[model samples]
Target: MARFFVSSDHIEYDDAGCAKNVLIKGTDVRHIKDVLRMSVGDTVTLCDSCGNEYVCSISDICNDFITTSVISAARCGSEPRIAIVLCQGIAKGEKMDFIIQKNVELGLNEIIPVLTEHTVVKFANAKDAEKKQIRWQRISEEAAKQCGRGVVPIVGMPDSYKNVIDRITSDDDTSTTLYIMPYENETDRTLKTVLYENKDFLNEGGSIKRICVFIGPEGGFSKKETEYAVSKGFTTVTLGKRILRTETAGMATVAAIRYEIGD
Candidate 1:
């Protein structure tokens, strides 16, 4: 069966707040009616972005929309126990797209494109940045659907390295956040060592809420950039002896974290 994400407003709820039906609109309508050639009585999975999923059977199909009756609803099972956000320095060309797609499949909760000192890609203006953000979001949505994710991971707008540092450092809930950066120069501490050291804190009564992983661009983070981030409470750890590419670094870090601490 196919899976699609539907907004809360398009879902009809009963007295008990259970989903009764769902209305799918926009590009998906055409995909369902023409591309997939699905008809009434066919079933599909609909996720409401709040980690709830509904098994819906098509009841009516229109030119511009599709109505489905909810058969069953439950919390999404594929979500990781701990939320992981990838703070990726924008890679050149299609590398960023590949990174977003693979990381979403590996259960990343969110991604923020960072403009760092060594970042090669530069937007001409704000409009250019916004346009790229929208495209990346679409890629995230598609990846989520393909991997049976209950909620599409968000791709944040491009942000400067300073802004990211400021936001994370200013977070009131610092106790629950594990801020990590993968630095090539950090040889003493390994990622596995860091994860193991924090294992107790991460699992203690479920107190650990979020894990933020920062990956550098092709040229990697400048020495000053890494120093500043480390000073602001971000732990610098080495992934391994060999250096990983910008795209591969995020995926590797995420997969390792999932294997170590995630469901």
Candidate 2:
């Protein structure tokens, strides 16, 4: 069965708040009617972006929308219990795209492209940044669909490293947010060590609800940048002895976190 994401408004709910039907509109209409060649009575899965999924059988297909009767609905099992956000330093060329795609597959909740001291790519203007954000979002959506993710991870606009640090550190509920930054120089603290030390938070019913992983660009974070982030409550940890690329660091960190948390 094919799976597609829809907004809450696209789902029709019964009096008891159970989903009864779903309306598939926009480009997906064409994909279903033409590309996939799906017809009435075909089964498809629909997610409402709120961690709920519906199994439906198509009842009608028209020019602009496809209507389906809900067969079943349940909480999405694929979503991780703990939300993970990747604050990655934007890489050059197509590396950023690859980063977004793999992180989505690993169950990341969101991504924020960070502009650091060593970041090589610079946006011409606000317009250029907007275009890149839009493209990154599309890549996130496609990856979500491909990996059976119930909710598409959001690709945030590029933000300065200091701003990101400030925003994350200023959270009112600091107890629930875990911030980890991977630096090559942080040899004493390994990711596994930190995770094991924080096992209580990673366990069920723990205070931690979100994890943020920060990765540096090609040339990596400057000493000043690393120290600033560390002062702002970000725990600096080494991924391993080997230095990983900007693209690989986020993915590896996420995977390791997921495995440790049993997500």
Candidate 3:
């Protein structure tokens, strides 16, 4: 069965009756009726974006939306216990797009486009940045749908490195928190070393709840910037001996963390 995400408001209850309804609006109507050719009685899964999945069967297809009766509902189990937020340095062209798509598939919780010291991409204005953010967010939603993700990961507005540091540290608890920045300049400290050493955070059979990974743009973070991040409690580490592209670094770190922390 095909799966889709719907806002909680799209769900309605029949007060006088017992049959709850799942209504799908907007472009999904066309997808169900025209593209998928799914008719009344066809089954589909609808997510409420709150980690809940509804098994619904189409009962009516109207001009504006598709209405279905809920067959059953269950909490979504595809989401990882850990929430990994990717603080990606905004790269030029479609690099951010690829980054968002792949990271969503890899179970990232959210993405923040950061303006690092060496970031080359600059928006024309606020309007331009807003448009780009919208586009990237849509890419995340699409990727989530394809990968059976229960909730679409949000692509947050681009922020400066300093702003990101402040936002991350504001609510972080030192004892359990893990904030990492993968840098090319760092050689002695490796990602594996840090993850393995932090066994306290990842206790036996206990999953990590919060992790933040930072990846620089093409030119990478400047020495002054790296030092500033390190000062802000971010553990600067390397992926390995070889260098990886800006886009690859985030995904690699996400996968490694998932493996080390037990996805």
Candidate 4:
């Protein structure tokens, strides 16, 4: 099924009438009229990012757009049990973009870029940071579409390492409270231990609904930072004995969470 995301404002009402016509604009207009070559009466799926999906049938085609009428509306598609939030130590160059794209596909709920003390790359100015965040957010949207995700994962504005940790500590405890960091020297236990031990932790309507995944930068999290995370109740678990690249850690942790929660 063809799927497109729309703002909640675009969804008027199904109670008003049986058929609701939808007018699409912007880049998606070009995609439907030109790239997809969709014509009048073609069926497609439209979603208001608030989790409502409408089965739509094109009713009219225009020079720059296509108008569709709603066929059905319901909440059918949604992420499964696991809700993962990735707190990644900002990396240099295109690595952050790569991380955002892959992690979104892997079903992460959000990405927080953390500026750590050891981070080598510096944003020369506000313009540079905005450009980088935009690039990463675009990659996340594209990856969401490719993976058939109902919603795009947010690429949050960059924050200091301390600020990121503080936010995690202050968040509600009704969420899944796992914090995974692939440390070099810490090998007390494996990821499998934490995951398998808490197999039933992701029960529906349970307190453990969200998970926090922490991935270090290229140089990895400083010893003091890791200690702070541990003090904040993060488990500081290892992926395995061998060290994985910064790019590999985020995806691996999300996958592990999904596997544990059946997401």
lDDT of 4 by residue, 1-263 (tens): 77787766565556865437666666777788788988888898876656567889988887776678888877746655567889998887778878888888788888999888788778888888888788888788778767777777888878888899988878775255766666777778777787777666656665676778888888998889999988887777888867888888888888877876678
Candidate 2 lDDT, 164-253, residue by residue in tens? 889878977577988899999988999999999989988999989999899999999999999999898899999888999988999999
In angstroms, how far off is 24's CA in candidate 1? 0.5
TM agreement with the true structure for every prediction: 0.98, 0.97, 0.93, 0.90
C-alpha lDDT values of all predictions:
0.93, 0.94, 0.89, 0.78
lDDT of 1 by residue, 99-210 (tens): 9999999999999999999898999999999999999999999999999999999999999999988887788868888989999999999889998999987784667889
> Each model's number of backbone clashes?
0, 0, 0, 0
Model 4 clash pairs are: none
What are the RMSDs of all candidates, in order?
Answer: 1.0, 1.0, 2.2, 2.2
Candidate 4 at 24: error in angstroms?
A: 2.5
What lDDT does candidate 2 reach at residue 132? 100
Alpha-carbon runs more than 4 Å astray in model 4? 16-19, 62-65, 173-176
> What's the lDDT of the predicted structure labeled candidate 2?
0.94
Model 3, 229: alpha-carbon shift in Å?
Answer: 1.2
Q: Candidate 3: where are CA atoms >4 Å away?
A: 13-19, 172-176, 204-208
